[model samples]
Target: MLKQYSFEKTAVQSFDAQTTLALKTEDLQVFYGANHAMHDANLGFPKNQITALIGASGSGKSTYLRSLNRMNDGIATVTGKIWYHGVNINEPNVNIYEIRKHIGMVFQRPNPFSKSIRENIVYALKANGMKSKADLDERVETSLRGAALWDEVKDTLDKSALSLSGGQQQRLCIARSIAMAPDVLLLDEPCSALDPISTVKVEETLLELQKQYTIIIVTHNMQQAARVSSQCAFFHLGHVMEYTSTGTMFSNPQIPVTQDYIAGSFG
Candidate 1:
């Protein structure tokens, strides 16, 4: 049996007063049937910046991330306010599909459709009623470029997406997401399955994209979080143990549990 340690909740540090919040959660909680998977998760994601949620397995970091975009709608019971654009998206009457159009998500594994690279990027646009050939063409190029894949696939647009390597396919999926022009991007362990070289590419792509999109990523990789995120939140047993700037969290963790986890004493 694993030992359970109780930790005092540390106040989540606020961003600069001049910083604009892209999204924020208030008293968020998640449950799977009867299992309370997350506690009151109050955190804000700064506009056009990257925030990394880090923790060991089953610590509820992913659960909190999923709630941001209501990805837990069908699988879990999520209660609280997810605020975006001055609206509480957690309301029962809120249109989830509409909310998703503004907040896109990428999963742990790369899941590209069994279509051509061009089709994979254009599919969502078409389904959303985009019909102009010129507009679609421009969007395809920009989205792919945004994902750092246009240079390699420009000459092979008609090739099957499955024909690409795992990393490329993941980038293609990101292209698909960005083609929707979402303001916020949520990534869940996107690089966990990739080789180191591929991981670097994805990280670079993220750094570039943050110029236009607020990003929230759930990752177990401490080094990757340090490299890509401006802020970091540590979760422990369904609660936020500490949330602060990435540099501060790593260099001088105020919470002993955070220090222990960062030091590899325990997770």
Candidate 2:
């Protein structure tokens, strides 16, 4: 049997309109050899709301996050149905490129390729089949402005992306992700590595972006989750101990596990 998270060949499950959800995992069970990283997980993610997946370090936050875009496809084996709109993305008939086009992701670390700042964002537009130079320039500017980094790097469009500070690089990454004009954004702890100012910029950028695209964030920072998310889902040992509004999850937790987790009892 093949295992997930091996970086071999990630498995994919694509779902489109008529699916009733921006994303859904129906009994998603993943294994890494004998270790059951994610149990029979079921979830429905709404469209256009900031949904935060908060949990301890190895609770499958990033695993589930990658599963959303079939970023797990590189692993040799994976089983389960992940519906996007209404179709199973794991099915072979669906278009992976098209599915990924609608779903964009940012990693825990800001991984920008060795390219000019302008080239980074433009590259995504080009991949999406935008060829006109004027159109490309407009999107590049727009995305950078949207990420709240345009004014800082606008004058250095041709500068190397590697030259920017950590926060700026992260914002650049966000710019590149949104340049694709995706309907949804998946962030895997995008602020864990940033300074306070940089983190604030990313959070602000998310606020600006979510008005148009549904956002799903996997964050360990309780404050970050508490401050930015409208809804919260707490996972523990592959189980969702609690799922509710931020207010309820924080102030009026319905589950003892949720209350303990919120109080920093056990991971």
Q: Could you say which candidate leads in lDDT? A: 1
Q: What does candidate 2 score on TM?
A: 0.89
Clashing pairs in 1: none
Candidate 1 on 1-267: residue-level lDDT in tens?
444556554747866778899998999999999999999888989999999999889999988888888889889999988889999999889998899989999989999999999999889899899999999999999999999999999999999999999899989989999999999999999999899999999999999999999999999899999999999999988999899999999999988778878997766
TM-score on alpha carbons, each prediction = 0.97, 0.89
lDDT per residue for candidate 2 within 1-267, as digits (tens), equals 211222222212233455445778887877777777776566777677788999888888788878778788766245789977678887767787888888999999999989999999988778768999999999999999989999999889999999999999999998998899898899999999999988998999898887888899999999999988977888776666566777778898766666677898766
Off by over 4 Å in 1: 1-3
How many Å off is the CA of 36 in candidate 2? Answer: 1.1
Give RMSD (Å) of candidate 1 vs. truth. 1.2
Worst 10 residues of 1 by lDDT: 1-10
**lDDT scores for all predictions?**
0.92, 0.81
In model 1, the Cα lDDT at residue 10 comes to 70
The C-alpha stretches of model 2 lying farther than 4 A from their native spots are 1-20
Lowest summed lDDT across 10 adjacent residues in model 2 is found at 2-11
